[model samples]
Target chain A: MKSESRKEEIIRAASILFKEKGYSAVTMRDLAKAMGIKAASLYNHIDSKQEILSTIIIELAEEFTTGMNQIVNSKVDAIKKLENIIDLHIDVTLRNSDGLASLNNDWMHLEEKNLQYFEKMRQEYEENFRAIVKNGVDREEIKPFNIEIMVFSTLSTLRTLYLWYPKQKNIDAEILKHDMISVLLKGMV
Target chain B: MKSESRKEEIIRAASILFKEKGYSAVTMRDLAKAMGIKAASLYNHIDSKQEILSTIIIELAEEFTTGMNQIVNSKVDAIKKLENIIDLHIDVTLRNSDGLASLNNDWMHLEEKNLQYFEKMRQEYEENFRAIVKNGVDREEIKPFNIEIMVFSTLSTLRTLYLWYPKQKNIDAEILKHDMISVLLKGMV
Candidate 1:
């Protein structure tokens, strides 16, 4: 494989292993074994196990933050913006199940710089949700409540899809998104 | 401190550390340090870190399961039972916040026997929710939907309170519980 493809392959393997066994339990040798490569050879793709973890979490955070930011900033009504948030959330999480797992469950292993970057992006993403909910409440588009709790509770619950969502099932992502957002919007409104 | 009091203190300290740092990140030495005792002294009270983890998780699981079971078997309306479940859930989570965190986030580190026991209790708790939802649907108290998804999603969302709930500044526990169960019941119905 080309160097780029080989590196991507190593990341994919590491992401799965890290999700399944966690960061501390997974070792460089384990990643190498999973990739059908020697431990020494694995060094060519990644500098260290922490590097792989950092890469996976950074990628996941970028996907979520970018998707949420774009949707929240788009020229749309508050309800539409809320719908887009749900769709974007499900889309990113479903496509990157292992990556999301690694980000949420294994983020403690990130270096300080990487962790700061993630925290910034996460805060930005949260601001988007808060903005939408705040706007909705201001414009009488959504019900009045503790906006902080409402936004955090909705987003936190959505983030946890990684825990129990079955990838093999035939559940249409859009339909599931519709159902979840409908329930949430109904409660909020 | 007496032996029993020392052991309780160790477990309490271990619970806080586990909540903040997670299971794999915490060690026996860390627990000992937190308790202001030597590592060797920890061994006298707890056999291992795993033992502490198991004790904490099982204690929380027992509380949850017992409370849920009582609500499930109660001679009450489905809606009232659902409210009871919500109230008990919030109470257990707040009363044993550290234990709840360990049970939800660190269960994978538990021994096989403990895992089996905890899993059974969790399933039983889930069944209680399922039964309440199903009964509500049959009694025309709830709307028609996939019971499995609805039950799991609602229950799991409630379980995540331990992660982001602020005991100091957030909504009071009783009001939060009332709002959550009201929203859930209204959305379903």
Candidate 2:
């Protein structure tokens, strides 16, 4: 792993702190103290706690948006696209579960323009997901279930992976990816 | 609907307030103001805000425990038991989604024995779910995908139904139940 910049270190520490205590509850002093640095030194690298939150959240949101965009535009079928999407989530989760936790819980605390940008990315992600499911139905690539139900069930499972995956120590990444893709796409029975 | 007892009235009003503004932020005055009753009147029915929160959450947790116990004890096969569990969540979501919001978002605020009780019920609920899935695999009634994966995927979707079900107006209960069971049990493709 490459040495992280001071800003990256601050963001990383803040993400974990935010996950534990929530965005509003975490102050910069708490963050600096966690890092064994003085509080004033933090302002040199980042402006405010909001900046840390937005950086942690927006960066992850954009990562998802980018992943979903590529998957949606790919020539693969809906099921394949979905597999890739699941892999994207697992990949992100494995690398930075703490950051994902902050993104999930602290995105709402984003201010003004950054908030709008994050929301837009999220909505587009969902819309792209919906369109893929609808396309699957139209082409008979998938079953004729309620489109919204299918979308909601699958997305909800994927979205909550950050909370579930960490507790699972016996299950490795490859097994998780393979089993998750199957259970999600092919069902349990 | 049957008439609500005065205590029930306070619990219902406080649940909505808790959902709107999280349990920590909402005050007894806020709940009383929302209910259009005097603060002293609220005290007459409910002992404290903690009482209101515990009543909403512990009651819902007990309801799930009861429903799961019946499902687990039934003579049905594992797949049938899983379907029954899905129906239980839908029934509860339909009945008191606001109370569920508190249970999901603020159950940690439940002090003392109530917190312990809620966690125990939640763990048992998950254990029973795991047992049913394992039984299904043994009986060849279900695929042997990672038991934890299957359980997590299904339960996460069901646990989050309260948040999603309220926004979906066009989909009636029948369709939601049918489609959810199908998508969760049989997969989307």
Candidate 3:
């Protein structure tokens, strides 16, 4: 494998182990074993286990923030923007379930710099939802509710789909996305 | 402190630490320090950290199951029973937020026997909602929808309130409960 591909492979293995066993329980040697490489050879690709966690978390945060930023910047009405946000969230979460799990569950283990980066990305993502909800309310597309609570509740609800959404099922991501957005919008509408 | 009060103090401290830091990050010594006692002193109040986790989890599970059972046995209609279940869920969740957090987030740390007990309580709690939804469908009280999905989604949504529901606010639990139940019922109605 190319160097980049090998690094990605190590990240993938590490993400799964970290999700299952948690960050503290996982070790560099464990990642090496899972990657079918010697423990000493693993140091060539990653500096430490914390480095692996930082890579996975930062990448996932980037994916989420980037997706939301694109949606917010698109030329769409508030309702459509909300729909798109939900779609992007479900898509990212389902596509990167392990990474999402680590983001939610293992984020605390990231180094200080990485933690700040992740938190900033998360706050940016929340701002997207907040803007969408505020715009919708102003347009009378959604019912008047506390903007902060509505935004937090909606995003938190979507974040939790990673825990129970079965990947093997034939459920289309779009359909699930539309259904969730519809129900939440209905409640607010 | 009295022995009973000392035990309560330990559980309370442990729950706060577990919520702030996760199960893997906390140690017996940490709990001891939180309680201002030596590490070995924790043994007098609890057998182990696992024991503390099990106690908190099982207690929450029992509260949920017992509350649901009482609601199930009540003479109210299925729709009202469903509403009551939602209200009780929010009430118990708000009152015992820490315990619920431990149950939802730290359940995997439980030993085999305790895990089984917790699972059984969870299934029983879920069955109450399923029973209500199924009966409502039969009576045409609830709109026709996928029963399994509806049950899981509703329960999962309510169960997650502990993660973010603000306790310091003056929002009335009953009103919040009524609104949540209204939203779910309205969507199906």
> Relative to the true structure, how large is the alpha-carbon lDDT of every model?
0.78, 0.92, 0.77
Q: List, residue by residue over A101-172, the lDDT tens digit for candidate 1.
A: 888877877899998998899888888788888898888776666676567557766787776676427557
Clashing pairs in 1: none
Error of 2 at A126 (Å): 0.3
- Cα lDDT tens digits for candidate 2, B1-189: 232587888888888889989999999889888988888877767789999899899999999999999999999999899999999999999999999999999999999799999999999999999999999999999998999999999999999999999999789999999999989999988
Report fnat for all candidates as fractions from 0 to 1: 0.13, 0.93, 0.09
Residue B163 error, candidate 1, Å: 1.7
Residue-by-residue lDDT tens digits, candidate 2, A1-189: 233498999988988898899989999889999999999989888889888888898999999999999999899999999899999999999989999988888888999999999999999999999999999999999999889999999989998999999988899999999999999889998
Better of 1 and 2 by DockQ: 2
lDDT for each residue of candidate 1 in B92-116, tens digit (9 for 90 to 100): 7677778788988899889999999
When only the first chain is scored, the TM-scores of the models are 0.92, 0.97, 0.91
| Full-model lDDT, candidate 2 | 0.92
DockQ of each: 0.31, 0.91, 0.29
- How much is the lDDT of residue A142 in candidate 1? 66
lDDT (Cα, 0-100) at A144 in candidate 1: 68
Q: In candidate 1, residue B156 scores what lDDT?
A: 62
Question: Which candidate should be chosen as best, given TM-score against the real structure?
Answer: 2
What C-alpha root-mean-square deviation, in Å, does candidate 3 show against the real structure? 3.3
Candidate 2 residue B172 C-alpha distance from true site, Å: 0.8
